[model samples]
Structure formats: structure tokens, C-alpha cells
Target: MILLGIVLAGAAVCVAVGIIADNTAPATLTVFGQHVPGVSSEAQVFVAGVIVAIFFVMGLAISSLALGRSMRVRQELRDLREEREESLTALELERQQLQRELARARGNQRPTTADIPVAGHRKRDQDPVSPFFDQSA
Candidate 1:
């Protein structure tokens, strides 16, 4: 993109220089039906070219600022998603730890009806009650 901008700028300069060189006649600008002071055609073309260049630069600056803002927003969204996943993983680990503690407190017996997993809870292929505890102890 930088190279393309540079090439386009160089082309514009070449065109403006050619126009100024070829048109040397005296000229006057009129705005709102009022005749402005007369000047060489080359000077008028140069002023017009300067105005166009200024507007082009302004447009580029505005677009660059908008692009920067968009990129920042995307980065923030990605960071938030990663943070959310990490939080969920931590919560799941805490939940499993709590379930193990509850079973131990109940003397490691089979769960009662009230101890059954809720409908909203994710089903596991293994037994809900962990067998890590040794009843022979």
C-alpha cells in the first residue's frame, strides 16, 4: 500500500509539472461571478494541484485513523474471548474439586436421589462419584 501510494504521488507530480510547463498563458479565476486577480496559468495550475494534494493527504489520514481503531477493537475482542475461556476452565476445575469434597464428606457412599446431577449439568460417560477415595482405609 505504501509503495502504491508513492507511485501514485509520483505520477501526480509528473502530470502537474507537465501541465504547468505546457500552459504559460495569463489567466484569471472567477468565483460567484466575481473576477479574481489575474495570474500566470502555471501558478493557477500549481495552486489547484496543491489543493488536490492536500485533500488526498487528508483523506488518507482519516482512513488510516479509522483502520487503526478497527484493528484495536478486533484485538480487544480476541483478548476478551481468550479471557472468557480461561475463566470457564478455572470454574470447571473448581466445580470438580467441590464435587469430590462433597462425596468424601458423605463417606464415599453412592449418591442419593437429591445428589443426582441436574438436567442442566453436562453428562459424563464415567461415574459422577469419583472412585479416587479408598473405602478400605
Candidate 2:
């Protein structure tokens, strides 16, 4: 579309110049020490300008697309890092809980002390009553 506009504008200018110069043959235009053919001047300038503009726009679009992809990847990496940190925190909490349980178990454990049972000294048939005072039997 831009190319079309440039071409139309160039044709209009050329037509005006032709009318002003009485349909003279094309001549060379020299500007800033640069010489381009006077003949076919409008077409040459319009095409070159349009091509440059198109390439510039294309470069901008490609750069934008690359930047967007890079930003998205960075965001994903950040999210993954957060998730990993949360998992590690959960594991640490679970470890602490298990340690507390183990400590409770160890605190509850106590040693028992009891004399050994003698076979011949306190037979059940010798004394049926409370045997605290039965030394004579």
C-alpha cells in the first residue's frame, strides 16, 4: 500500500514537471554530488524509497517477535524456580516433624528394674495367706 502511494505521488510530480517543461526528454538529477538518470527518475526514486521502508519495518517486526519469546522464557524459568523452592520447603518441614516424633519416642523410653524370680524360695503351696509374717513355715 505504501509502495502504491509512493508510485502515485511520484507519477503526479512527474506529470507536473512534464507539463512545466513542455514534454522534454528525461534529464539527470544531481543532488548532494549524487547523479541519477534524469529519465525514469520518478520510478527509480519511488521504488528505492519503498524498498527501504519495507525492509525497516520487517526488521522491527522480527526484533519484536524475538524479544517477546525471550521474555516469555524468562517468566517460565522464574515460575519453575518458585515451585522448586516450595518443594524444598515442604521437604524440610516434613523432616522437622519426623525429628520431633523421634524425640518424643526417645523421651518416653524408660529402664525397668525387677529382682529375678527364685524357684525354691517362695512356693505357692507353702504359704497361701499374705506371706509377709510366715517365717516359721
Candidate 3:
């Protein structure tokens, strides 16, 4: 929308300048002390305005392309992040299942607490099972 406004304003300025130039008297223009004829000031001004407008439109187009590319890149990054998160969640679930299976295979006894001591708990060196006891013995 802003680009449209700028283009419209440029066109209006071009038309106004052309109109003013047409109303003014013809002036002699010399280039390198050489007289240049057959070219009106209005025509030159109109051509310059057209060139300016073309440059402005080109700039807007380049900016739009860059903006689109950045948006695409950002979307791709977001998708990748989501995929990583989903895979991580799945792996964590698989790990928990494996741990439960291992504990069941070892026997029904599951430790209620980690090896680390808790507050107000007594530490004992007595073995839960005698070293001489085994199924083969």
C-alpha cells in the first residue's frame, strides 16, 4: 500500500512538472559551449521523471524479494525446531519404557529411593542378601 502511494505521488509530481515546463518559455541550453537543439525542456524533465519512477519501483521489488526469502527461511527454521522437539519427546518415552522393562526383568523389587541418602535416614552396612546364598548353592 505504501508503495502504491509513493508511485502515485511520483506520477503526480511528473505531471505537474510537465505542465509547468510546457507553460514556460523556451530556453537555450549549451553543452560544452555547443548549442543543443530540437529537444524541449519539458521532454527532458518528463524523461528524468520516468527514470526516477523506474528506479523507485525496482528498489521496491528488490526489497519485497528479500522480505519473502527471509520469511521462508524463518518458517523452515521453525519447522525444524518442532521436529527436533517431537523426536526428543519420543526418545524420552522410549527410554522410560526400556528402564521399566529392565527393572521387571531383574525382579519385582524396585528401589523407592536413589543411592543418595535422604535427610533423617539411617545408613546401614548390612547386606540385603548373604554372599554365600545362590540358586546353584
Candidate 4:
């Protein structure tokens, strides 16, 4: 809507300027190395207005396409950031679970030989003697 308004305004200004110039001096325009015979200033103004409208429409189209492309890129970046955050959170949880398991394993350790008991012997740390062969024999 704004673009339309701008184009219309530009056309109106061009036509008004053309009318003023035509009222001031009525003359023929010269082209590239050739004279445009019997061409009025009003006709030149009309041509200039058409050219402005064409350029304005083209500019609007290019800008709209650029905006659409930028929007798509922004969305993709947002999605990628979310995925990365989720992955990082999962890795942290897995690391915490592994640390807990390690701690549990360390706490529940095996007992040493001194902690065990032999049959009818309270001195479990000392070597047992054979009854069949005495030390004096």
C-alpha cells in the first residue's frame, strides 16, 4: 500500500513539473544525435512518469524477495540453536549419572583378608599350624 502511494505521488509530481515546463517554453526535444521534431514538453513528462513507475515497482519486488529470504534464514538459525541446547543438556545429565555410579562403586568396596574368619580361630591374620605335624617334631 505504501509502495503504491509513493509511486502515485512520484507520478503526480512528474506530471506537474512537466506541465510547468511546457507552460514556460514550448519547444521540440532532441534525441541521441537526432532531433525529435514536433515533440511537446507534456509528452516528455508523461514518458518520465512511466519510467519512474516502472523503476519503483522493480525496486519493491527486489526488496520483498530479500526480506523473505532473510526471514527463512532467521528461522533456521533459531531451530539450530534449540537443537544444540537440547544436546548439551543430555550430555550433562549422562555425565552426572556416570559420576554417581562411580561414587557408589567406590563406597561399596571389597573387604580385606583380615576381615574374614577361619574355623575356630580368632587370630585370622596369623598363619594356621597343622595339627598332624608339631613345630617341635
State residue 66's C-alpha deviation in candidate 1, in Å: 0.6
For 10-120, candidate 3 gives per-residue lDDT tens digits of 665654455455544444333334444654676774564576567666656666766677799999999999999999999999999999999999896677666667787
Global CA lDDT of candidate 4, please? Answer: 0.65
CA lDDT scores, all candidates in order: 0.66, 0.60, 0.65, 0.65
Model 3 stretches astray by more than 4 angstroms:
1-39, 114-122, 126-137
| List of clashing residue pairs for candidate 4 | none
Which 10 residues in a row give candidate 2 its minimum summed lDDT? Answer: 23-32
Write out the backbone clash pairs for model 3: none
TM-score of each: 0.55, 0.47, 0.55, 0.44
**Superposed Cα deviation of residue 39, candidate 1 (Å):** 6.4
Candidate 1 weakest lDDT stretch, 10 residues: 28-37
Q: Write the per-residue lDDT of candidate 1 for residues 1-137, one digit (tens) a residue.
A: 44445555565565555545654344644433444465446577468668657755755666666667779999999999999999999999999999999989998987677668788775554436556763544
Q: Model 2, 12-59: lDDT tens per residue?
A: 455435433453333433333444444356666556446545655555
- Return whichever of 2 and 3 wins on lDDT: 3
Per-residue lDDT of model 4, residues 41-121, tens digit only: 767745755765676566566666666777989999999999999999999999999888987889956567877775777
